[model samples]
Target: MNSSSSQIDVTLTVKDSLLGDGNTGGGRYNYTFDPDLIHVTEHDTEIVYRLAKEDQPRFRIVNLYSTDTRDQLDELEIREDGAELKIVHRNTYQQLTVVSLLVHDTKHDHPVNCDPQVTNDPPPVGP
Candidate 1:
């Protein structure tokens, strides 16, 4: 499979209001791409969410689901570190689809930068 052909683009944005109150805040993130352009089952991809250094311990994931079906994708496994959130998918029969993620935090009074990166791993070598 061609790795470049299965690349997916993700967009993440935080509202200014989230930076005004330290109480509770949330943001919506979306992932989208042309279904015809990528063959999901043939590629393995990971979505990495990295938080700004200072915001590492402040923010947390509230809920994440598919916008189209409003249901979580069972194929995804989430891993979190002090500053990074990683979502991994090895092989899925489902098509590469759109998804929405919600992140909530208590230390939102300060600007919290979140960067998302998508990496498609090459399939395992065969005999």
Candidate 2:
């Protein structure tokens, strides 16, 4: 398949309500995307992924980032099982309105250029 089509790009925004809850030890949030759209391997390391917030909060006390590691950062964990991607928030609390998740294979020498437009609406609540 083509390089651009092989890339996986997803943007997520937490609702205002969820953002508020983030202040009080945020709970685990699950996000699922189509596995068929991108390639998936048994090993998690095959996919190079990065997650970040589109807008930063005012306070530095809270930490916001995406990780696949379990209980590493303030008990914050992010797990990926095939098509499913789970987000966990630990000790720190902050509002993450806009989230950008990019995933692509590392085997390719050329960069995967898939930049989706930003949206204000939050991602769906359920898995």
Candidate 3:
């Protein structure tokens, strides 16, 4: 039987950051998906990642982090307008799981040209 029940928030967003990881002493490092980058304080360090079509439900990674840390590590706030990632500590990844932050890539800002038709090998010659 389909019964209607009260809807509760199963997952939390970046806006609810203050309430995140109180005991962990830190919060999830928030990331946004939009026109990026805005320098914060001089000491603050910023890292950027481009989430391709494959990287979806981006929040899942953060949730996995929370569970793995046993809630000791808190989540940081990530907003579209936010260009900086703030942390109470040096902001090292401890058991954090995410790939391709694009730190070393110098040409990251430019859109990637994905040509399906381009083949590395030439066509075979007919007999």
Q: What TM-score number comes out for model 1?
A: 0.41
Worst 10-residue lDDT window for candidate 2 reads 54-63
Q: Give the Å error, residue 29, model 1.
A: 12
Q: Which consecutive 10 residues in model 3 have the weakest lDDT in total?
A: 113-122
Q: Where in model 2 is the C-alpha error above 4 Å? A: 1-82, 89-96, 106-127
Tens digits of per-residue lDDT for model 1, 1-127: 2344333433333334434442223332222222323233334454444444444466554444553332223444344643444454454333344544445555543333332222222345234
Q: Sort the candidates on lDDT, descending order.
A: 1, 2, 3
Instruction: Output the number of the lDDT-best candidate.
Output: 1
Question: How close is every model to the real structure, measured as TM-score?
Answer: 0.41, 0.21, 0.18
lDDT values, one for every candidate: 0.39, 0.26, 0.23
TM-score of 3: 0.18
How much is the lDDT of residue 36 in candidate 1? 20
- Tell me how many clashing residue pairs each candidate has: 0, 0, 8
Residue 35, model 2: Cα distance from true site in angstroms: 16
Q: How well is each residue in 7-102 modelled by candidate 3, as lDDT tens digits?
A: 111112221135454222144223333323221211112222223332323322211111223222233444332222222111233233222121
